[model samples]
Target: MNPNDHRAALADIQVTAQDVKFSTIVCFLAWTFAVYDFVLFANLLPVIAQDLGWTAAQTTGINTWVTIGTALVAFFVGPLVVDRMGRKSGIVIAVTGAALASGLTFVAGWMVGALGVLGLVLLILIRSLAGLGYAEQSINATYLNEMFSHVDRKNGGGASRGFIYSLVQSGWPVGSVIAAASIAILQPLGGWELCFIVGVFPAFIMMALGKKLKESPQFRARQLVTQWRSQGHTAEAEQLAREYHIGEETGVSPLKAAFSGESLRPTLTLSAAMLMNWLGILAFAFQGTLVLTSGKQVNFNDALTILIISNATGFLGYLFHGWLGDRIGRRNTIALGWFLAAFAFAGMLWAPNGSYGLVVALYSVGLFFLIGPYSALLFFNAESFPVETRATAGSFINALGQVGAILGGVLFTIHLSGLTQESAAELISSTWINAALIWGTVPILLSAALMLLARDVRPGRQS
Candidate 1:
């Protein structure tokens, strides 16, 4: 390409400072809302289970089903939908779908008297609809990666990118804090159903913000290339292709592209790593909720307090790990997080019954390490793939993680069901060490090992 045409292409794709700021804010808000919706359900699961006549086993079953549905949508549906509609439109639709589905949770409560068992079915269906929006989380990752490509390419930009990504990733704990506060404040006044009603607000806010988002330049460039090719403007198409370093066939099926040749190794390795990581996460999230509310370890009030404090500390981990990822390396930082988290989980398991401070500290540290590298992993995963298949590949890896979560839930339920209530209570109170060994320690160590096999894909770093 000539200098004039090269400049023109650059002009068309360059992102301004304002665009970066706006994209970051909107992406952060989108993540915040997504986690708010997700964690709210976990927070209120006990109340919902009681209202719907669900036993502990049944509750886990519902979670498994929901996760399975989420995986299916994220893996099979997300790539096709996002690739067709564009990321911005896909996110808007997802946010709206989540909000609408969440609102129906309120209606589920009303229908219980008239529909009885059918209310349970309706509620599960509604929950699955909300789960479908999990795709937006992956879409956001891809969008952020692409939107900041120019910044990420500069010298010393990796750390800056990691910091920004961490800030956005902190939305998970922020949303968790919101969920905790909502339950502590609102659940007492109007019950869990009302909390679901309040949860709908953030989704709409995200939808409004998402509407103003511009398409990523990489995506737009791909579109322009396609248009030029279709118009038989071979010269312009080839010029743009060379400028962008995009391949001739830019529109290959994402799934085919993701699993083909060199991409397959990292893709499979990351998927395995995600699976193990999520197993540990699901175990802690669901089992912690049970241990807290069941009074096996602590009272509901005390549990909520512990959760809020732990999550607040975990928020700091998100930022710290992001910076660490840039400084050390993505794989090393993530491995360090896993190693620390394994020890923290052990500490939580062995704390004495009356050692509230010890337990809280252990839980907080464990939560921090467990979640610390998540943002970095997302950054790593996105960078691992080319623009054409980034979203699909990342979403597929996340879908595999959801499957691991489902398996975790099932295992927890099966174990719980095998013992009498008294024995189960005793086991939880005493044998938590064993539980931690299987659920938290083992899985995380495995995840860390898997990270060793996967290449680091940080920007400005060679794989």
Candidate 2:
């Protein structure tokens, strides 16, 4: 074997158990906090709207703007920033910014009486600013993959990676549950503003945890090789390159590398899948609003109860899909998830009005299917590119997904306008249900079909 191959083999023996533990905890919490801040506004929008005298259209418009902000950051800014700054620094800044923005919501709420329309505008601006922090999620995914390289490739691939990623992605439901619980507790105490206030705490926790994080070794090694080469220490660079089995230095920009030739196909395919997934999530975002405003008009406590239950069930789905992805492979698992989610959403739409049990059951199952396979999907996206361009590619796909979120928000707002208090209950229920079918079920099925074209990147497997 060549010296490089031997060195690569030896380097693999250097990973320690502590490294895995720290990487997993730090990445998972950072992701969880990022998602928590991202979704916190959605959960509390109704109360905020009422306080600000904003209409449904205005509310959805604000959310759409947030989606747009997320896309812009994830696609245009994140790739460049993360690639240049390193993942650890990028995530810390993003998370800190998002947390501070979330805290600003309370200030916006307080200004409503004085600023009126300006307060609403400020709220929208802050929330959209918070959305920029979502770039951390895509960046961190790449970090985790590199950090867990050894374990991720063990047992035919995806054993450790799948479990860790699923756990990390479960941060979505966990964040949602925290949102629900916070609203449940805080809303009654000091009203909606308190919910935003409570949401800010997770950021501090994440920042503290983030301080303990080490830069990804892969990133460090790559930088070292680049530095050596630039300093004309070609021999040293070559020595390090063999130890890491690093590929030839590509002259192309990361963006060009991500979409060039063969890579373009799977890149587009995963982007399509993510777009549909976000569309469904945007529709699902209305569940709280629908339950509160439609068919029998349940109280805030009841609506939150339903949401908590549904999100709790979503946690199980994440675990299931993580396990299933290892067995069936990422593409198959994601396809199955989308298909099952479509049926579950359909059942939710078809359920009788005022049937809380049935609605909750269907909602829970639908959410499970919609959310469970995300970790595996993300893993697949990360694996689609080389280490050099992975973050950019994943973030680019995420940016496309945000476009779907914007569309879903717009569609949801338009549909919600038809469900005024003067409207008949059946009409109100059916209008939102039909919107859910269109926004949730249709795209999900399309995503499933698109999954057929995606290449599975599981270790030891070829598509």
lDDT at residue 438 of model 1 (Cα atoms): 80
Per-residue lDDT over 312-428 for candidate 2, one digit per residue giving the tens place of the 0 to 100 score: 998998888877887778889999998999998888777776788887888889888988888777777766776777777888887887888988888888877655545676676
Each candidate: what lDDT? 0.75, 0.74
Per-prediction TM-score, please? 0.92, 0.90
Note the residue pairs that clash in candidate 1.
none
Q: Which stretches of candidate 2 lie over 4 Å from their true place?
A: 1-15, 150-158, 242-245, 286-288, 295-297, 416-422, 459-463
Error of 2 at 168 (Å): 1.8
Task: Report lDDT (Cα) of residue 204, candidate 1.
Answer: 61
Predicted model with the maximum lDDT: 1
